[model samples]
Target: MGLKKDYAALADQDRERIQRWSVLDEGEQAAILGDLISSPEMEALVDEALAANPDLQQTLLTLRIRQVQYRKTFGDRLPEIKGGYTAGKEEDTDPSYTGSLSIGWEVDLWRKLADESRAAGKDAAQQQALYQSARDTLGAEVMKAWLELIATQKNITIEKKRLGVLEKNEAFILGRYKNGLGTLEDLDSARTRTASSRASLEEYRENLARQRRALNSLLGREAGPALTLPADYPTVVPPLISLPAQTLKRRPDLKAAYLAIEAESLRASAAYKALLPSIDLEAAFEDVADTPGAALLTDPVWSVLAGLTAPLYQGGKLRAAAEISGMETAKAYQAYRETLLDAVNEVEDAVGQEQALKKQVRHINTALASARSNRLQYREKYRAGLAGMLDLLNVQEQTYDLEQQLNNLIHERLVNRIDLGLALGLGVKQ
Candidate 1:
């Protein structure tokens, strides 16, 4: 028990949140999740999730590593310097001493280093875009769970109210049976109807628990209390909709795929550059003295040489590497195309759902109103013996079904609204 907390604290100390939710103790997880559920809005919870998600943080760390790689490749442009001292006592000579300095620079006559650095920098940018994409997706999922939890809560309330009505009617039917005004079948049907309502209420409660657990998981904690959403939380579909300009710029995943292409192209160019001869300028100085302590080498005793190295033979490995890089660049383009298509599909589907759900809500609201009215008339008819037990039960079931469907429609409209925002690439920053 103590070890779990110790491990969680240790993981929290890491620069990158690499540990999974398993690191958290069950009680600690519940406490943290309860606070998120108590918040006024899901935005705060979404921010916490994105900030605390270990996978997202690891992606950022990976980005930083790529930046370091860029620096190392660019640093190759700087000169390489070394120095050494030698002292020895020979049998035929006094203490002999020597000091030396050497410098070598590639001069980079062709921009090979620059190309490699550019590729590395672009990869870092791509990872950055991917991280933002993850943030956008996480926020959308949180909102969706919030919507489901709210709808389930409302449905439970509705079910309880309906249960109250059924139980009250059952009591009235029992009194009528005692007076010989209603048949045994009618009394039994009322009791059966009340029992069904109870069962429905239990089902709603179970679903509510499931939704709460899902919300907690997104917050990277154990399941906790049910979260209540505000009444005004975007359930109605918006009237205005417009196609965004330069849509590709909005999606981070698409941008990352595009950056991959350019980065790979630069890398391919650098690979070809590797096949050419490399020219380096070398300079060195040496000094000798009779004593162990010798003066350092100076310009007065120095030599310089311009060296060239050509890849004369490598069993075609160099050529193969260059070819592989070119193929990777081509593959990047295909990935970019695939990502673009997926982005387009997501946007269209979100838009379609928003449109369809908005119309469905209005139509369902009308049907629900009619169902409520019809059920009221049937209840009265059954009490007076004009309607049969089966007829009353059928009407009651229909009314309950309509009420539940209405709840689902409202939730769907709200969820689709959130999905549209994510599909348009809003709410996430890179």
Candidate 2:
């Protein structure tokens, strides 16, 4: 199957799991939420999740195993030693025992073993780089969850303020209606606006709760109270640099790609070397006894042997293997190039988004100011009986809409800032 198909399958599985848990009892849900909010083991839980998050943990374990494999491959250059004992007993025969020791080593005349070891080492390094890439991605995801939680809390606060303003306006309209200075239309419009604002407040509340749940889930827990953020969130523009070379060297994914290329290159070399002649030295010693009291050491025998292997004809299998290795090397190089291009595009996109959001924030601030002024003017005119209920309502709605837009712009700006930081691989404590 294709990569997208695999990802879709995994996502569908996760969605099913989420759906299954969503029907949990209220008390169970509360307990989970309480654990997220108050458990002192929260940090430990996060650590455990990281260690067991299937994809990441698999990469980490793969890297570790590859390192061991690489070490063992290199150890092939050292001597191999073996020792054993033999005993025999037969009817009408005394027991016999013998001990022997043997040692052998392969002489890497063409450095083929060393090259294969290098290839394995490169593979291990590539795996380590992939693990690092996974870790970086997880960190960015956590940051995104934290940011979403902050944005949701901000939305809730803004919604509350809006509801308060609507309530005050409603009270004013009610007072005017009671004094016979306002029509029922004005009171009804005010009541409707108040209800709309309250509805919006409740919507934000629900959204905030959902965002909290998602954040807590990322932390490997249930929903909890809203998290606090810095009073003034820091924003920094990413510095533009040489894209291709820098990304290839700096980005973990790109590094892994390059390492893969190196590994494939070495593997191809090793495959070609396999077609050449190889020499191995072998030595053995043995002791035998026919009786229990026999002197086995005095009856020892030793032998030394050396062998050379040259693949004269392997039914085209060796050539085919070499060809396959060459193709893999080519594929690895192409993948590396593609990864470098992707990194460059990501950096460019992040930079562009940051710039666009900054401009948007300025325009939003100007629009918000105008909206506030118009709302104030409409209120004055309505109080003086110079503006119709619809006119006042229109201005109030415009003000609220502008305020919401401004909040969204602020949130977008923050998100873009974080994205730029991620693109540059910044904001991570080394």
Candidate 3:
């Protein structure tokens, strides 16, 4: 059987809507599956999620705001200016409009401004690392959806093939019964088996359709056209890589954790520097125009001054801040180490799954071959009256089961390959 009846006759509009479905090769199908998993639509949804994903977006936005803060931290090294008008009528003072311009600059001693800037810069870098971590998570989710769709489609194909074989066998047994050469029990058993296979095929088709819809939802799209899949789906297998070399740097979560630790360390340093004294330089000018009927020129008053200030006590707030920062730094360091270990474990487990599935594939293939050979031999013997119909039926059933098992093994192999790729931080290839 093909797909469902409703899916059989493609309307002109429907067919035109999905022109790509008509010309899909196995490789193209695989590529399209990858695209559906990681399409722009899906990426856009991820961006939206990132915007609303409180924990992540908060960290990212905070990092950006901190970049501005870091730049402002250097403000202590630059001049500040103010311009305003002061107009009032006071007791014993003449009513006049006074306009004044003032400028103040803080001299950074002990590189405090430099340290704060470095800390802020580190905070921004940490945010970048967090964004990368989000990306890695989204990538893994996409890979999972893609693999599941592939598995469902493969299962449907295998079930359909078995159903076809069962129908053929049923027809043959029914013919023999009509010719009085087969028992009623043979006919009934064949019919029952055929019906059961049909029911299972339908179930597989339904499950496949459900998975397709779920994948479409993940891609941020309404269900579209039918998906075509590779005829020979590859098994999952890990590519060789130097685990020790890649674990820390290549894994996004681990990198993010490390950056977080760096950020916290820098923050701690900046906090300690907050307790020192700072110097300030100030300058100002006033320009007044008093016209006596027709004036020729105006005189302006200008002055310059410098000052320094030191903080004596603020109830130990600054010292407490430094202590808190130190604790946060230590916490970040612990988190970084934990993330590294987790990444290593994930890679090792994926590699193990790949190896185990490869062995399974070999055994399933061997079993399929033997079962097929036995089915063929038994059919011939039954036709020659050298074997009973029951013997032929049993062989056929065994062959069918083995074929399905092999199909499952093949699908498992492909899933393992995908898992390995994800573990290695590889995106789906074009």
Candidate 4:
């Protein structure tokens, strides 16, 4: 439990203990999401999923259950009251009516009840944080799927245009072979490339269909028609803004982890307090009358009682229970630390990936410009009969490949920006 205490202090350095938890409503949540997804359609889709998604709804239900459980635990601190009524006739006694009432309570001399109640409260708070985390994660997931669908559509377009170019070149090669200006080998190679390009276009189409289905599922619907989108990808990608380390506390997963540590610590305290002696007080009243109305209005007897209970011998079970709770507390602390480390690593990795992908896209753009210029020169040489058909085709293939590569890199950079925003805890909570 010493480790648990130490980790709790580390967690507290970033933020105060979670007591009363609240989440931003959909409107406010949308504002946070705009940082990563600015499209109105995407925003609307996220809102739809938040409202209709079954998994998210389940998490919310679990949070409410936890809240109810906390209230039950809190009720344990109050006195318990019971009432009973009876009517009977014995062989040697007159018909009688009776009523009894009793009240009992355990005095929390060692704050054991308080500890257990607080622990239950913390459990509820932990679930609330987890619910928010699920929500934030769902929003990011929907946006990622939308981004994938857009990129896939654009990729299919690039492949279709490429197929068109290959088919045009294949026809030119056939004409050259018919006139004895090109070898049969050159004609066959051109046809092979054209066929491969056509196959690739089909593959891209299949991928597009699958991506649409995935996005449809996220929208809480069965697969249907392809979603409508703009003819082009958005030109604007959100900037990579830096955030302070403390921003990690805003992440609901981290908040849940922190709450778990506190909850376990409180449970451990309550378990150890169970070893101490406890005091219980009880009071009862009972009345017997020949008539029901007399029983209700008059009491014939009254009694009061107090009891002290101590665990003198229980096969060391109480001590073992306390020890187990302590170990669990320590385990909870370790989990929190692990989560904290992962959060930091995720942020660093996303930032590094964004920077790396940007450099790659820049370098690819430069290479594409050079390759396109080389294709132009090769085309000129072929027209003057200075370069063979194979040489011209090879350069053309290289230029087309570079164009596709550039398209992929640009899409990848955009996706990385989404990851970066999520890592920095943007849109998670306010």
Candidate 5:
């Protein structure tokens, strides 16, 4: 099938998966949305990436070649057939014509060809798994970038608010100074804080633009139309249960590793079987006309021959090659184990991150609440002439700082939650 048709089918599958997402429980939501990489909306991005990523396209092409190789393996055991016609004329002789047909085939007495076919098939599957791994990783990164961009936009708003409050405080300080109730030092500090807020706001804007370019690149498009970020962010963290370790086994990278071992083992088997004898069956038929030194006759003739050859001394090279394949299979097995362990470690780390970030977010929330209340009090005190300009500006700065910090912590918690889902292999169906 064409990649276009395949991409459409994949997009439809994503839509179906997402359609079922709304009615699911939180845990199921995590499982389902995680596969969609945190949201149904991401389906478009992933679909575009799948169709446009050069690396992914290259993998699909390689898989196609491997499929051809697989078919050729079976073909190897089938008889090869050929047909030919030739004509020749000597100085004083009529032209002689000959036609021939031939067949040659190898009988797979040791099933080596079958083993090789299995190995080739496994290699193709391994490529598929690797492609999936790359796709999942690309999806996760795009999701993260989108989330961060949203968070940064929110931070920009906060900074703008801070700037507004600072402007108001500066005005109040100016009025107080005119009445000899504020010091020069207070005015200077107010100006400095206002400048800082403006700079931070611009910085956030710059980061936001950079992130959009990144997201566009992932979507296989140039930056033109602005990407939309969802107003609601995900916060529901799913607990890892229900044979989480088994999930690791199904991870695409791990699947690739396991398939590598299988392929290698099949190759090793084929290599071992190579030490056995091989048999070739050959048959040929020819039609002849006019011979110089023999009876000239227009006749058709046929003959068949069976040939067998046993492997003699190859100076132990074949044995060494088999041993190399065996060792590679062993290495692949160990690599699979390592991949599984790393997946487990990532899950644990994400869980740990969720625990710590939630606590930190909670604390920041409390702190943000306190800062707002304190800012209100300071505002009222300055208005009532009970507090100076310095106190009001100081509280506003504190509130501003806390708001930025709180935004960062919450964003981190959400991103880490996404990471946990990814680490658990929740981004793809088993």
Candidate 6:
């Protein structure tokens, strides 16, 4: 209850037109991730990762265990029946048989047992939410790896093109130097640039291979064949431009934390009740006969017993336990608040990062345009004998460097968008 009130207050604190909570549609998850990256191959990868992830499997098992525990706790609220039979013939001509049956139930006058059962049920549900959260996280990781693979492949292509241009320039400079038309210094400079370009291209290729292997590992296919990835980046339309507080409310991790608070509160209530007196009712029957069947069917001795028990004194153990549970419940509340605050920060930070990256992309685009124009002018000047080849080469290098920068920035922005969607707790449809 405290967690919900805190959430409501946090959600209402922000007042802006876009800050207004948006109503999520039935297909909202699809819309968010689909707009981020609409690729069937990526979706399949995510599904495989979720299915094969051992950690997520462990979480599912944990959830099952929690459910079983809840069942056992609920069973405690009902009467318990036990039966026994004994047969012996010691220095006797015939064997004698005895049968006994007993049932006991603690009257829940204070609803203590009910609270414990409810607490166990809530704990199970919290585990379920944790499982969902794990699934969501695994899916996001797969998609992220997929995106990085595509971006690295594209970067490799860009670096190869750069290398090719540098090689051709090196060949031309070599030709001029042999004919005494260009100085040895120019020839060496061109060769150095070509070597650096080759080195950069190799680094990109190595990075691409590493990324592919990482993706494979995430899919639990370390020995699988190389993945055939698309060369072009997927078109992304960022969803939730106007992020609503409702989106945060849907985060499974947050729900798990909130459920923890409730479960702990109930447990604290049960612990406090443990300090009070408890009433128990027990009924038992016993019979003896020549046969076990006869022992059960014949008239028997029966007793109905009722007892009231209270914690007289145990060095203040019960009181200490109650106090501990109450403290634990309070800690759960604080934990929930901390988790909620962190989630909010992550979303806001991602949104701000996306905006900053977009602006950087725009500025880089303008600079790239200007650099292209300058490169063209330098080339013309070099041909007209008004500029040295070095000047043209420098401008060309500047242009290519800007192109590389723009490529990286664009991909960085796309990755940031993916992060933003994930931070909002959007799920993949797989």
lDDT of 2 by residue, 9-60 (tens): 3322332332211110111111111121222233334454465556666678
Best by TM-score: 4
In order, the Cα lDDT scores of the candidates are 0.71, 0.67, 0.62, 0.79, 0.74, 0.79
Q: What would the TM-scores of all predictions be?
A: 0.81, 0.79, 0.70, 0.91, 0.84, 0.89
Clash pairs detected, candidate 4: none
lDDT of 4 by residue, 239-282 (tens): 34444444566777888999999998888989999999999999
**Model 4 stretches with alpha carbons more than 4 Å out:** 1-6, 13-31, 91-93, 235-243, 428-430
lDDT of 2: 0.67
Candidate 6 structure quality by residue, lDDT tens digits, 281-316: 999999989887899847889999999999898999
Q: What's the true lDDT of residue 126 in model 1?
A: 90
Clashing pairs in 2: none
Each candidate's number of clashing pairs is 0, 0, 7, 0, 0, 0
TM-score of 6: 0.89
Positional deviation of residue 93's Cα in model 4 after best superposition, in angstroms: 4.9
Error of 4 at 107 (Å): 1.1
Q: In model 6, how large is the Cα lDDT of residue 238? A: 62
Error of 2 at 71 (Å): 1.4
Look at candidate 5 and tell me the lDDT of residue 37. Answer: 41
Q: Quote the positional error of residue 208 for candidate 5 in Å.
A: 0.6
- Whole-model lDDT, candidate 6? 0.79
Off by over 4 Å in 3: 1-77, 86-95, 136-144, 171-192, 222-226, 234-238, 280-315, 381-398, 425-430
* Alpha carbon deviation, residue 94, candidate 6 (Å): 2.7
